[model samples]
Target: MSSSLASLALVQQKTGAAQLDRFGDPTIVGVALAYFAVIVGVSVWAARRTRTASDFFVAGHGIGLVALTVASVSTSVSGFAFIGGPGLLYSVGLGALFLILPAAVTNVLGAWVLAKRMRLLGEVRGLMTVPDAIGARYRSPMAQGLSGIAILVGIVGYMATNCLAMGYVLDAIFGVGVTWGIWIGMGVTLAYSVAGGILAGIYNDVFQGTLMAVASSAVFVYVLKLGGGMAGLSNAITPTDAGFLGPFGKMTPLAALSLFFVFGMGSLGQPQAVHKYYMLRDPKQLKWYPMLKTVGQLVVLLLYFGVGVGVKALVSAQRMAPLAKPDAATPSFLLQFTPALLAGIVFAGVAAATMGATNSFINIGAAVVTHDLPTALGRPLRNELRWGRISTLVLALLAGLIAQYSGALVAFLGVFGWGLFASTTVPALAIGLNWAGATRAGAIASIVTGLATTLTLETLAYLKLYAFPAGVSGTAVGLVLSLLVFFAGSWLTRARAAAAIDGDVRLVMDV
Candidate 1:
């Protein structure tokens, strides 16, 4: 069976290069247009439901568990799972295991530590954004404002990352210039996001997530069928490259594990992931959240592993040439193996979802700028929704432009955004929400410490001034420092005797 499978895979690889030549197939273009029409329809429906600020921010806190689960999982998948993940695996083999570890674990950990506490706070405080929860938790305008600033910084970087990815995707599929592709992505996303805000993100996520799940599954099946089977593929690669099958692949063990700390522990600080917590309609439904989230994440991630291994196997067997660039691995796979119709739908859907994800980042950043900052300063805007829409458009446009001119700046910001969020919010928001002794001073200090550490380290590394140790990522360092500062600051501030959490909040926490 293995011998036959290997032969079959070799035959497929020989033919795969010919498949890549179908650059602008009409079938693919047609599918993309049809899928886009569906997205526009969903955007209109969501826009109708999004007349109020609360509706724009949290879908009026009416999103059901199933929808929230799929959407949350979908949002987390982002560009990394579909586009970058396979490339990552191709370059470093089992180095992606560190990422996969957190991918599986964070959901359960988040459900236990964050889901209930955040959801409860949202219900009790009528929270609209993550910074709103931070403000209410710490009862400090300074902490709220500082967190808002941190969110804004992260948003620029996060949005830039998405824009760059979209640019590449559009360039490949439509043969357009990368800059034009980014502008196109920004225009489409801004239309619905400005119209519907989080409602657009939520409904679009559900729609996009369902499409991604189906397409990802079909692609995975194709990968397996083309490769014959995973075991056969493994055997083919094992002889020539033993390390490729090892647990750490080519990465230093320390570097591999650094991905874990950054992604696993740092995930709590991710405003985007935790953003969905506020929209769950029922608190008890959270009991099922981790399972649904994990299952959905794993299902979508099959493409990440399948294509990486399948392509590696084919290359080792001399049936395929080695990839020209790691980033091209995914596009190469789709062009070669998947049916033209399916490839069109999957690629277009993934690109649309990328825009939708960017919409979310812009929406949250706008909320922080317009609603949370003013509210913290005790001067709430009467026209918050209007200003927020304006901010979202501006932020998206700014990010798209920045992505085109300053790829390095985007990389610097994007690299630390996760850690910055994790370090700043994890202790102050995630842990603090559960720990009553968590003082406002501590939250404030931690946010400052995290922001400072991440910016300094990432910038220095980018400048080639004393690189981070091979296994040590800037994110892990920042996160550790932030936690330490939070504890030390809290201990000192506890001397003043902080106010107890509100009776209502306490009551909800106990529930």
Candidate 2:
């Protein structure tokens, strides 16, 4: 009898531990349901306000500064910062920090170089998309059409990354398989994006951003407590993984710097953030945008660094088993270690990040299909507001398919998307708006070069057909080539370039 009792007790203890390790706790499910409810409600509210193409695409240029800042950060960070970022850190140690630490300088650069100019151009021309701004700046429909094509390609990849992360979150919270999770997640995002457009996306971003900030701060504190703080975390990881806490972590110096440089300069061209300039209610509020965006991003990034390092410390300390996959790092840690309620909040935050980004991308891509492409072809859509929502549906489904089949880590896909945007847009749109010397020929040349080079290189790498040097990235090379072609093309055609600048565009640049 005594032996039997002991056996029963041991079995019960083991079962309890197994249950804890599994996802889909009742508390977590409950919180996630509530979060979804809030999202749906916000979407419905915004739908009522979305009356025209302007409202759908640019929120009628009435978004307050605070909302714009929060929404931009929410879109920019997305699942990359919350989910892929932690996973990258877990895989590469401190090198992953390179991906995020550039937010400070990048935010400032975006404001000084692009924010005011984009806003003024939007006002001057009633522009609605990044391609529109490019067309307006260069006075060339072909430039707009090519850039629109580039944006469409990048949108699919970037939206897939976010949708993939959402699938992971849904799988953890609902015990649905990733395939089903992805479809469900995409459905929810589509509901809001199709109905409310960017107006819904903006407010949704504010809500999601607030939740993510609170949850990340709380999780960081919990991580410190579990790992016995930074010094203890370092000691725990260093013995098993030598130099895991170095400045460059597991990556070479050149590789780490490449991440910093690419992400820093690349950020200037990210349509998710750059597009928001058109929605800001007051251009003067641009003075505060850099500071506000940087602070918000830093607070949220605590989770990015904390989860990766904290999980590593625990595994090294023999307190937890090693993770089966790096991308599982965030979800695994939350399920087993954090309180159920906190875990639920973080999961919801992950979904929020993904959904917020998807909404913005959907809106942008739809505008490209419905507005920019047609306008470039000299046949603007008569009912852009209606066709915009339909385009959103088609784009969302296509992106969902890519999210399922891409078979790449979330972080890598995110980087690929960022690179595509930077390569295609930076020289043409960002620089062209600032430099009257930039010609239509230069803008068209840069877009074509960037689009072709990035696609070929990234595709080959994905298929294992080619590889770059140990510390080099295809994106860095593509961006460099694009920049060179932009300047060289302009210089070679300086007379035409000078003649191409419109009086209104030149005035906007001066402002």
Candidate 3:
């Protein structure tokens, strides 16, 4: 039995060695670490000016256009873009291209419609947080409390998902244990986030976003070259493996449409993402904002699809078989093909992407707890700045713990958090801002219905029971239902409270 065990070990070592040869070198770990240090140093420096709750939560409402643009893209596109995106293309083929359409639409719509109005209102009303905006809109503590809780829940899960991706990258690149990777990643994010808050997050995001853009562009060029040029790479794939050219590839039409709705409309509702709009120094600076944002997004998405397609074409299926997990693709690709220095840059980019998103969520979640909850509970809550920092540390720890236990799938883990936020908050917030007839009762009913319906649908889907149709996401359903209840409830309650309504709400209808 001992001899048999020895033989098995020998065989495994040989196979592992062979896999490493085909995949690439493993010493890029040092390069990756150095890049991370530089980013953290920048974040620390940026934190020096964060003196108040407003500064910590929204950079004192003074974010310039360039900083806001970079931070927006970085925070919105997480490790999922760096890692899981390529893996999806590797497995599903061309159909994944459809995912880009919704992003394009959201960017244009946000720039033209949402960004200017939100910034105007945020400045006018002194709205520092999403719940603050909601509470002020309808004069309802219940709306504020519920929205804060929803933000916390969604952000915690989102933060955990990014941490999980960071851990996977460390383990793949450095042969580190998953536990050590998670702890180190968690520690770094908590240190910077707790120290500087939104200032730190936005600063690091600018640096990290630049790194991700450069690295992804370089990787795309190099991988295509290595794959024997575009034509050569195209010729290398089997008919089925050429899914990048197809309409839906492995995803059904419904599933493809679902991705669009989830990623697109979902952006309008994300607390961290939308919060950036509120922080801009001047709404006038937003004239070029959409163009800048779209260019960055296009570059990132193109590189993601390029890398995934290139890897599927160049790398042998047998070698990539073990890396069927989406989160494994980026590291596996680097370790197998790229040189040590460039590979290190890619790894650092991955970590930056993860940390950027995590910091954004941590700061946003802290804001929810410190600003929204205390006000909702009607507590005096003095020393608001101190509590905000404390809340950041606590929330980061909770999210890190969740990361430790989460499985390795990026999209699956992240979609729940994204879906929850979208269903519960997006409709109410969006409609409240646009419609004057929106009442407290309607907003409350909408929030409750959105939350309850999303949760129930998610639970049922998990149980393999009847689920919402494919193309129509839970978020879509929640948004539609929430809108219905919001309007209907407002209509039913309008006559009784018509005279008593506040000036801001009544201003539009009276006009």
RMSD of 3: 4.3
TM for every model, in the order presented, reads 0.92, 0.96, 0.89
Residue-level lDDT of model 1, residues 376-457, one tens digit each, is: 7889899888998999988998888888887453223445667778878899888887777788889999999998988888
lDDT of 2 by residue, 1-511 (tens): 6985566555446534753556668899999999999999999999999999999999999999999988988898898888899988988899889888889999999999999999998998999999999998888899999999999999999999998899888988887977888899999999999999999999999999999999999999999998888998999999989777889988888888877877988998899999999999999989999999999999988999999999888777666666666887888788878889999999999899899999999999999999989989999989999999999999999989999998888898998999999999999988888887888888899999999999998888889889687766788888999999999999888887757788888888888
Better of 1 and 2 by lDDT: 2
- On TM-score, the candidate that comes out on top is 2
lDDT of 3 by residue, 1-511 (tens): 6985566555446546644663324457676767777867876786788788888888888889998998888877787677667777776766566556677778877776457667766776777888877887777888999988877888887888788878877776666766677778878888888888888889889888888888888888888788777776777775436555568876778777776776777777888778888889987888799889998887766567777777777544232333546566677677666777777787788788888899999888888888889889998478878888788888877877887865536655577778778777776676666666677888788888877877777656656586665434565566667768878988887765444445654443233
RMSD in Å for model 2 = 3.8
Q: List clashing residue pairs in candidate 1.
A: 255-471
Which whole-number lDDT from 0 to 100 does residue 190 have in model 3?
82
Residue pairs with backbone overlap in model 2: none
RMSD of each: 4.1, 3.8, 4.3
Misplaced by over 4 Å in model 2 are 1-22
